[model samples]
Target: MGCEAPATVGKLVAVNTSGSYLWEVPLETEKPSGGFGCAPAAIPAAIYGTPAVEVEEGLVYVGSYNGKIYAINSSSGALRWVYPREGNLQPVVGGAVVALGRVYIGSSSGTLYALDAVTGDKEWEFQTGDKIWSTST
Candidate 1:
């Protein structure tokens, strides 16, 4: 899949870092004249929840308003996979937490999902009576 950010103006973040950004969510991929090519996954429309990174696994996990959880390569920011591969999950309002071998995240639908850290596969889910807006510890 591909993403094109809206032309509308938004915040321009400036990070004082020792290295350049890991990657840019591409708006368009370069045309391959006659060779193999790779395209990054689509970016979410909005993100309220902070992202969690698994250093040892080399993955950065983040949930989006589009109701999906994404596992991106930490060094390249290339999307590795997304949860509920078919998407359409409840809006992930809370940040994700990586522990043991799972990624735990909550949604506005009051459901918490536990996914495999390496694959973004659902291991299990829990439903609460109210929306889950707090980040999991």
Candidate 2:
């Protein structure tokens, strides 16, 4: 994956087992700047881990360091949906997993989220005492 600071643009690259580039999917647009009255602006979204692929569904799930999860079409490299449906400031350092028709991912905020695989709807969320930066088994 290619990621640059201050820019939300990142690429989810697919490589064949033979070390060949298969395809690449672009991430979200440039991140907006916002914070408390005088607090510093938050960092842009960036990919920091591997993506989870659901071969049966032809979908790939990836999380950004800026706290957004994306669902992309495996064959077309097109974006399907993004979690939170609005904001992009939650740092999701962990990878996502797909199972039972849902996508599971965690964030630096210590929240584990379960989203509908097809609709990107929030099914439920669990808060933890610390950040979850690893893939949920």
Against the true structure, whose lDDT is highest?
2
lDDT of 2 by residue, 24-83 (tens): 876664663432111144344556667889998899988986567889888888789988
On the 0 to 100 scale, the lDDT of residue 1 in model 2 is: 44
> Alpha carbon lDDT of residue 41, candidate 1?
31
Cα-based RMSD of candidate 2: 5.5
Question: TM-scores of the models, in the given order?
Answer: 0.73, 0.77
- What is the clash tally of candidate 2? 4
Candidate 2 whole-model C-alpha lDDT, 0 to 1? 0.75
Worst 10 residues of 1 by lDDT: 27-36
List lDDT for all candidates, in order: 0.68, 0.75
lDDT of 1 by residue, 1-137 (tens): 54455332211121227654335442122222231112243333355578887989988787766666778776765778878787367766679999999999998888988999998888999998788887988
Kindly provide the TM-score of model 2 when superposed on the true structure, using C-alpha atoms.
0.77
